[model samples]
Target: MTMDTAIARPELLLVADAVAREKQIDREEVLEAMEQAIQKAGRAKYGHEKDIRATIDRKTGDVRLSRWTEAVETVENEETQIPIHIARKFKPDIEVGGHLVDPLPPIDFGRIAAQTAKQVIVQRVREYERKRQYDEYKDRVGEIITGVVKRTEYGNLMVDLGRSEALLRRDETIPRENLHNGDRVRAFIYDVREEPRGPQIFLSRTHPGFLAKLFAQEVPEIYEGIIEIKAVARDPGSRAKMAVISRDSSIDPVGACVGMRGSRVQAVVAELQGEKIDIIPWSPNPATFVVNALAPAEVSKVVLDEEAGKVEVVVPDTQLSLAIGRRGQNVRLASQLTRWDIDILTEAEESERRQEEFRRRSGLFVEALDVDDVIAGLLVTEGFEGVEDLAATPVEELAAIEGFDEGIAAELQRRAEVALERKATELEDKRRALGVADDLAGLEGLSPAMLVALGEKGVKTLDDLADLASDELIEIVGADAMDEDAANAIIMAARAHWFEGEEDAG
Candidate 1:
């Protein structure tokens, strides 16, 4: 032991006490920090600061700094050693070669040693803070975080998320809402991920998957794995469609996501800034899927065209608006939900489409024809709802209606003359549309062109129209003109067509 070891001992302990009192930490932490820092400083100085030794007592929380050397047979280096007999003077139990603990006298640390201590302390603190940050966010993934909007830089949203700021990109922001500095809002934490800039917080408003994620948070069944969200399709704020399957079967997936009385869905909708959500059941069958997709709007029939990724859903004429939604949102979402192109129509539109189809199918109207709505409606009002009706009916009979006139009769005659041709043309168009093939097979799709072809072929009589064989017609008229398909289409269109004369007379 040496007198120099005693000098600095009191001062080192005093620093430890002072730091503990100021930082309100356990005394051992401050002493341990000092011991580590002083050792690092001594290492940096090489032999220059050989007397600077530091120790922290684990039991008493005491800190001490001193200089000493072992009593070795021979001193390898003077900086860390002492003569063997010199170490034995401090203790009777100490042999000549045994180590001795010596105290260093109080002395001002040089500029370099002080700087080294400071660097080590700073590095330790930084490492501690790093671990603290990692622990803080690691458990916060997939949770909602409330943050105040900080600033906007080139449409990028900067939000102060308590301990750190999160960057919400332009695409992640809600479509109609603009974030201003100091706006308070909540966002879902898509992920807590390490990035070059540190933890990157991803926010989303338009993501289709976001809907399901949101429900999983709010719905107990979903969180417990009782309900599974099958798929989601969104139009951002205005509309979104989702498909859900109940794992339990007993628990309703749609109702569960929608909440008891909509409280659950309202929470999600509020977070989405008023986005509309339709929770529909998922079906493996294409027909069933199409029906499910047109939610909040009842579907009577679903005609599938799976090969073309298309489907036609039929609804009553009155539900036309609801089925299509505002600017066709319902059908659009349905298309997104079912992954199929959907064509929507009112009964009237379907009827009009049927007429076009029949014209093609019946070999009636060939091309370049537009039927005015008024005439069509008039004919529709008069039981001549389709071209096939006019094709089989006598021109004079159609003229017998209230607005009857020779000119009107001739017009009816012309229309009926082209019925089958129009129907056949319409059917071909519908066929290319890749919807249901049978959708055009109904008798209501007749065109006037078919009627003319029929009259020319001596099939104008009512008895003839009734007895017409579509297959025989196809054989006689050639596949390109009037094939069996054309004959059958003509008969179907005429039967399906509403005769204005008959309807008016009735």
Candidate 2:
């Protein structure tokens, strides 16, 4: 090639513009990459250790190759640096810490030099493309996208998402939804992560947000911010429940989501392969919300245990199966939507349980307090559960019960306290015989009776108590004896001795 042809190739600028437009990156970056590739090829022609640099004009694509050297006070390397005495001959005013540029002849494209340039260009372009993919998709997480199934490996589907490929793992697909190559699919962008191989975009059709997004597209109220999706739970292709509330009192959120004649909901259902959707109105009160979630089956009563995070729902006998759904799906979705554990039962079952609990508490009161059946029944009806509650109650509160005078209340309390004291004395004797450590009794949360119970359960030492987890402690004692928090506190107190030993060792 002639020197003029080698120096400035205008066609190179056209190639750079096309590559930049196709790769969706800056044209300046592609020009820089091309300069580096040409510089490497130039280095292969010249000495590799020399600082050979190449530059391309942005406007004209004029290429220039040069070798750079620093003018130092002391002569170091003869190839790149020159002494000031020698540099002054060329510049006539050379100074230390200044750079000198020496022009080099244009490289003749040998086979190996051309191959090296091609490799550098390809590598740099691929890096830029991967980075572009990462930057573009990172902020698009939680968005819904459409794609075509490119191929399947095992059960994973590689989808062509226009700009890049995305992964739809087998477990993230809707259940029993058989997708083939070239099939169009819509999925939610759950995650965008950069891996060693490349930027991975993970899509999911079974994500609960997928249903919410579909609703947002179909329901104008949701898109307009008049209605909000409170929560969503999906059993994927079988059934799904969504809770929605309206910011405006004038609009019915559930009705708006259902659309006119169920057109909006039907659209979502068609996309989900006929997954049943229940649009329920959201309520701040968990009990009311749970009642709404277990719809199509009437709830007769809902008893909530807030501390335990459980709700008991009572339905009619005929509606039990419907309330629980096929294979317990309805109740499971209700529990997830309400963020509470649900126990469903028929009205008859609840009534029978109530009677059994009444009889059990009545029998215990009668035997422990030496009271008659009528007095025991009265105490149980007044909602007193145990001897401890009776003994702890004030005389006035006890007398407030129907058919009980102040004198009878005082007598009942005295008897309850005496029985409890005798029981404590006997338990103390047993605790001593079991070799329970005395330090465990000093724990703040443990009462004398609770300590005795722990002794019986073989939690003898402080280490023993500390070694047991909170759940294990709660199990050793009755569920009503303590909550998980109190159990954790007691165990921590027992573990304090370990910290003291650690400090001593330190």
Candidate 3:
């Protein structure tokens, strides 16, 4: 190409404008890329070791090339740096560390140099496009976006999302859902990450947020913030459960999400390829929420074990199959929606288990308190769980039980205290036999029974207990004995020696 075409090429500005418009990127970015390409070609024409630079005038599209050398007190490199005395001789007011620039004649583009310049421009433009895509999509995470399927690779779909392409991985697609090139699809933008190859925009059709977003689009009440989605659980293409709450008491959240004749939910289900959805009203009461989550099956009773994050649901005998769903889908989804572990039982099974527990506790009272079956049964019926409960109860409270007076209540409390003392002595003997340390036994949260249990598990030293995580300690001592917070405190207490050693050494 001629020097005038290469130097004052107004066509270069037109090309940058066209590329910037097509890529949906800033025109300034395109100009910067073009300058880099010209600078690379200039460096190839000049010596590679010299610092060659190029710039394009924004208004006229006039390209200028120059060589730069730094004036340093010591000449470190022959090509890029010059001695301060020589630099000052050329530019009379030059200071050390300042750069000196020399204008050069425009380069005549050879075939290889033209090809190299094109590659550099293309690569820079691609990098700018990638950055633009990342910046645009990163904050759009958790939103639902529509795109056309561009192609597929190894069961993954590459979707053209207007200006950028996103990958819907095989596992992120709803099971058995099919898409072909040019097919319109809607998915959730779950993540955007910059990777080695390029910025990756990850889309998911099976994400629970996708279902929630669909409801928001279809239900005006939800979109306007009158109704809110609390939680969602999906088996993806099979079934899903969503919990919703209404900020306005007059509007029913579930009814509003269902829309007129189920239009709203049906739209979401159709998009998910016939995935069945159950929309339930959410409650602040976890028990009520869990009962609602297990839809289509009537729950007779709900019991929560807060420490373990577990709930027990009792349904009638006929509702067992429906409550658990096919292969436990219903209960599993309910558990996930409520963030609880669910154990389902029939009414008959629950009643049988209650009777069995009554018998066991009554038998213990009878053996330990030397009471008759009638008296022991009465204690168990009155909610006295063990000898500890009986000993802890006030004599007046014990005497308040029907068919009991002050004399009987006093005798019972005395016997309960004796039994507890005997149990503690036995546990302490067992703890000693197991070589449990005295310091561990004296830990504030640990009881005699817990000490013996820990000793049996070989956690007999403070260091051993300190090494255990809160969950590990709970598992060894029994979750029913202490919750995670108490376990963590006990472990922290055990670790006190470690910090003490550090202080001494310091």
Candidate 4:
């Protein structure tokens, strides 16, 4: 057929336009998809080994098919590249890196060729649609999105969010939340990822962020930025805790969130299937924040060990169970909200533990320094927890203590040194008996006790110590005994030999 007959196929352009409008994609991409489909059909008709290509006129919908090869100095691939010498025969001015095109006859839409073209067009269009969906929803992550449950496959719910499908994994759903097809759901778009099948949007109804967004929706103060949700923790369908702070000093953030007659928080609670919510006022002080987080349970005292990131909360005997909650849910959510490891103790338990510690320290001092109970009691009362601290105390510091004369201080110091020496000798014997290496024992940060502990755990050699991660070492030694940075330093010291060996080999 002539160009006039081919141009008569204006229905081709109409199809591209209709598909672009239906798919809500760019018309140019649709045209490109059509061009690719035609090129594929051309390749099927001709030899597949040839570098066949196709193009469609944007306005006229005229389809052109051709075979192209790159002009190169040396043709490595014979089918797709031509030697510069041969390329110059067609165009004398042809140069390397230039393309040479040979037009092919217009393709007749045979049954198989037309089917293959349709498949190519459909596949390419679907790919573009997937990419569009991914781009559209990727930015919506962490925002609240509403969708309808399309279906459930193996406990995973596929939700239709208008343009794309989102996955609500089994674990991400609120506990005890049941849904069937066509159930409307609101969730937090936690993640959007591209996969082999398509763009996968991961939604979560149980995420703490979901609760926060719900509060923002129900409370105008939060949405308007007058109140800020500092942190949220959820038991998901059971209970949740949210900490809020107000930018305006005159505004009460907790009250604003609760609203008049509890209307604001009630809406969020209803959406969460009647999950109890504690709207605590956030504080700049971690202790005060933790105290507020553990509301409905009075806290008498909070002893914070910042180094260990743990808080000891003491409550009255009656409030102990309330503070701990049934199965410890209250304190667990409080810990999550405050970002601290909380240990709840009743007043009686705390007092008993204090007395026990007092006796333990007094006994330790008496045994180590050969002092009387009265003197040891005085040392213990002076805030000495261990003999190591007593021994490390400067003479001036000891003399400053009440009833500690210079001579008494000097005697205490001498006794402390002697006791430590004796303990070290015993630890050294224990370490040797356990076959702990001398090099590991000699490491600066590894005390005699730590060396003995390592030996007991089968980490005797420097190499063995080097093999342990910081967390593993912290596990072996208690968190209070060593922190991540100190443990990492010790591990790096243990690894020094490896580098030395490398230098020696070099």
Among residues 3 or more apart in sequence or in different chains, the pairs in candidate 4 whose N, CA or C atoms overlap within 3 Å are: none
TM-score of each: 0.48, 0.90, 0.90, 0.89
Two-way lDDT contest, 3 vs 4, winner: 3
- Residue pairs with backbone overlap in model 3: none
Candidate 1 residue-wise lDDT, 1-506, digit = tens: 33433223466667667756654455666666677787766555445646457676654434456666666778887777777766666665776656676564444569987888877765654444344455677787666678898998899888887657777788877788877899986776666676544566666556676677778889989989888887788988887888889878677788888887899999999888899888889988888888888867888777777666778887988888999999878888888788889987667777788787555433322222245545555565575545666667776776777766768767766766665676677655644343322333234534434344444566544445566577755654455565455567666665543475788789
- Give candidates' CA RMSD values in order: 20.4, 3.4, 3.2, 3.2
- Ordered from best to worst lDDT, the candidate numbers read 3, 2, 4, 1
- Candidate 2 yields a Cα-based lDDT of 0.91
lDDT for each candidate structure = 0.68, 0.91, 0.92, 0.91
- Candidate 3, run of 10 with poorest lDDT: 1-10
Report the C-alpha displacement of residue 193, candidate 2, in angstroms. 1.0
Worst ten in a row by lDDT for model 4? 1-10
Ranking by TM-score: 3, 2, 4, 1
Top TM-score hit: 3
Query: What shift in Å separates residue 441 of candidate 1 from its native position after superposition?
Result: 44
Runs of candidate 1 with Cα error greater than 4 angstroms are 1-40, 47-116, 150-155, 180-183, 205-210, 213-225, 248-251, 259-261, 296-332, 335-506
